[model samples]
Target: MTGESGTTRLPRQRDTTPTAQVRLLVAVGTDKHPFDRLVDWLAQWHAQAADPVRLTVQHGHTPAPGVPGGVPFLGHDALQQAMADADLVVCHGGPATILEARRHGHLPIVVPRDPARGEHVDDHQQLFARRLGAAGLVALCETREALHHALATGLADLSRYAVAADPHAHEARRAAVDRVGQIVEELVDRATRRPPRWRAWARPDRGAKETR
Candidate 1:
């Protein structure tokens, strides 16, 4: 859009399909670290309740909760396909997983790994999940109660997190790409044109050849 001051703005667009169309996919991650807390919580839920949603779980490094048909891990391709078919995704707070869920049109219900509980090396997962939650990108659940509540309520209205295509956002992305390209070009030029700092350290016997 052209602004009053003659500045052009990128148009933003969003389109959403109703949530009633997909199944459910759950994953923690393939990290070596076990997320038994999440796994156990899920297994307990599965065992106790008659969940109507068709659920497929990728338990990852954690021991299977012994859920009758549990899968230890779905390789990348299988996971992607599962996400594509899912209306809701229950997952750990890894940023890549969250983004992948969103790409598949599900606003993931995320339980971030807590390092205090030895779920991760640090609290980055919790921190990142909070940030995304604040942006209305993912539903954040810190405890089993919260996770259960989110799943119960969220599955019914998956459209709530459906991303709408916005032209403004698209334009901003293009602008960001252009800016990054410019910065990369500048860095490459500088690296190529700048004199080698090791020039002074060159062997005199070698005619002071510049070191790479």
Candidate 2:
């Protein structure tokens, strides 16, 4: 069904059909860069997977996946509703998206954009994804093989990817905001604190006399 702003609403009905068990919501965010690689991987998986899976893609700048449920963007409420209805949440390495999924009781499967592949401006996504992965906050899939494995695993046991929704969601959101801020600050400090070439060049010999 069409939602506000012409966005397609994700199907909320529980289909009793045998193939309707697994519902995936994939959001690649609304970044300027096109994340064609992730969309391509989803298409490849959907085409080849043995089971019938319901896949809804919020593709953003990426080219349409040519699938039935391909929405370019979702409004705030629509996204939240979609996430609530999804059995599995697959998304980019965006921190906000990751946290939002978690708030909805999903341990999201994340694929960080690659700067080497022109998916993003730099490797910050990769860096942040790794950090969160290390903390066991997300399932970080950096390769097609890994993503495939994650999809297969999540489909097999949906409960494995599910988390307990925080009772205090508002407090959780505040904490998430603070956590993201810390991570960004750390990343910025790491990037900016590197000794610059100018610093080395401007350093004068300790024994040298003062300039006239």
For every candidate, C-alpha RMSD to the true structure in Å = 10.1, 7.6
- Candidate 1, residue 30: the lDDT equals 81
Lowest summed lDDT window (length 10), candidate 2:
3-12
Runs of candidate 2 with Cα error greater than 4 angstroms are 1-19, 198-212
Models 1 onward score TM values of 0.65, 0.83
In TM-score terms, candidate 2 sits at 0.83
**What is the C-alpha local distance difference test score of each model?**
0.69, 0.83
Model 1 lDDT tens row, 169-192: 445445645654564455446544
Per-residue lDDT of model 2, residues 3-42, tens digit only: 2334443322344456476789999998999999999988
Report the Cα lDDT for candidate 1.
0.69
